[model samples]
Each structure stands twice: as structure tokens, then as C-alpha cells.
Target: MLGRMGRPGLIGLAARTAVVAGTATAVSGGIASHQANKANQAAEAQAWEAQQQQAAMNAAAAQAVAAQQAAAPAPQATAGGGSDLMAQLNQLAQLHAQGILSDEEFAAGKAKLLA
Candidate 1:
């Protein structure tokens, strides 16, 4: 009887040890997975913030370009001296002949040049 009781006690102790080790492994794995998920979430949030900042920078650059365009002077209709009226008239006549300019537009341009 003493031998049989000793055997049962040893078996029970081994089973308890196995159950404790399994529970500890499961808890540790769960904790590690939770920590990894938190880290991933943090990384994702940082990426989102960076993307927003880049978008803001791009918008600022575009606004600066628009401001520069608005502040700059417009180009002149003719590049040379303003006194060359005959040459301009001839160019207009050619454009009218080529059908690039309508009759009314040609007349208006001629009037503007004469004025």
C-alpha cells in the first residue's frame, strides 16, 4: 500500500507540473502577441502622420507657385519696339488670309494697332 500511494503521488506531481508549464507558456505567448500588436499600431500611426505632413508640404509648394504666378508681370503681346506698326499690320493680314483670325478679329486688331 505504501508503494502504490507513493507512485500515485509522483504521477500527480508530474501532471501538476505539466499543467503549470502549459499555462505559463500560453500566458507568455498571449502577452508577446499583444505587445507586437501595440507596436504595429504605433508604427502605422507614425506612417499616417508622415503622410499627412508630406501632403501639407506639397500643398504649401503649390500655393507658393500660384502666388509667384500671380505676383509676376504678364508678357507683352509683341516682343520688339512698339513703333513697328506696319510689320504688325502685315502679320495680321497674313493671319487673316490663313483663316487663323476672323474678319471681325482682324478689323479689331487693326483698329487697336492704329489707336
Candidate 2:
């Protein structure tokens, strides 16, 4: 048989359903937020690793350039008066004084002057 108070019973049922649905939504949103935070942290870690790799590559490139410069011979000075070599030596000294050239460069240039 049909219930005597049908409308009130239906309304109460609808309200209870709405409350259960809201609770489920809140729980799902919490889980989604947690997942998003984890993804962000992983991305940040990857970015940091990439930066470190790039820094290492840059250091290696600089070392290679220094090695090449060291291996190459210095230009021969002009035979007229030894003035060209003297000028180059003076310039090297100035660079050393200004902290532009390292000790290795100064020594190499000086050795070239003697030879």
C-alpha cells in the first residue's frame, strides 16, 4: 500500500542522499590534491637535477678550452729586434697583474719569450 505521508518521506530521502554525495566528493578532492602536490615535488627535483647536469657540462667545456690553449704553441716573434716578443711579455705581465691571466698563462708566455 502507498504511504500516507509520501511527499515528506521523499524529501527526507533526497536530503540524506545529498549529504552522502557531498562527503564522497570532499574525500575525492582531498586525494586529488595530495596527488597534485606529489607531482609538483617530483617536477622540482627533476629541474634541480637538470640544472646540476648543465653546470657540470659548463665546467667540462671550460676545462677543454683551457687544455686546448695550453697545448697550442705561441706565435714566433719577428726577427727584426726582439721587440715584438718583449711587447707580448709586457702585455702578459700586465694581464697577470690585473688578475686576468692565471699563473699558468703567465708562466707559459714567459717560457715562450725565452725560447
Candidate 3:
């Protein structure tokens, strides 16, 4: 029994091994691809969230600038308006020191005043 059909048995064993190896490779490849896709999606979501946060910050800065401009006194026609602009700048600085304005807000306000 040990010597009978030795060659045929070896061939059958080799075929079975190949089938098992192919199946394992396909399953592993599928799992790896799925994981890669999930990681890509997570990264994209994180990037999108960061972009939205940045946009919100930009809009807030613009709003703060507009607020500062509105708060400033308009230039007078009769005399020098330098003091009026300087007073607006001082008020903005005080607001920032009191923590009423964030750093972004303070910068925006200062930019508007200088403009």
C-alpha cells in the first residue's frame, strides 16, 4: 500500500495544495484591499473636516474685521481724523486685552483699522 500509486498520489496532493494556496491568496488580497479603502476614506474625512474648520475660522475673522470697522468713527470733514482712527485702535487693543477678542479677531480688527 505504501508503494502503490505513488506518482498519482503526489500529483493529486500538489493540485490540492495549489488550490488551497490560490484561495488563501485571493481572500487575503480582498481583505487587504478593503482595509486600504477604509483607511483612505478616513483620511479623506479628516481632511474635509479640517478644511471646513479653516473656512469657519476665515469667516469669523472677516466678521470680526467688519465689526471693528463698524465700531470705528467715520472720518470728519472739518479737521484731522487721525485721532479718530487712533481712538478706534486703542478701543480694539482694550477689547483684546480684556479677552473679549481672540487672536484671530484682534488681528482682523487691526488689519481693518490699518486699511
TM-score winner among the candidates? Answer: 3
lDDT for 68 in candidate 2 is: 52
Model 3, range 1-115, lDDT digits (tens) per residue?
5556545587788999999999999999999999999999999999999999988876776677577567756655448867877877788898778766678878886896688
Q: Which candidate wins on lDDT? A: 3
Error of 2 at 38 (Å): 1.1
* Clashing residue pairs, backbone N/CA/C < 3 A, model 3: none
Ten contiguous residues with the weakest lDDT in model 2: 60-69
Better of 2 and 3 by TM-score: 3
TM-score of 3: 0.62
Weakest 10 consecutive residues of candidate 1 by summed lDDT: 1-10
Pairs of colliding residues, candidate 2: none
Off by over 4 Å in 2: 1-8, 77-115
Which digits, one per residue and each the tens of the lDDT, describe model 2 over residues 1-115? Answer: 9666645577788999999999999999999999999999999999999999988866665565467557756666556857866776787788678755668867986896677
Superior candidate under lDDT, 1 versus 2: 2
Candidate 1 lDDT, tens digit per residue, 42-61? 99999999999988866665
| Decreasing TM-score order of the candidates | 3, 1, 2
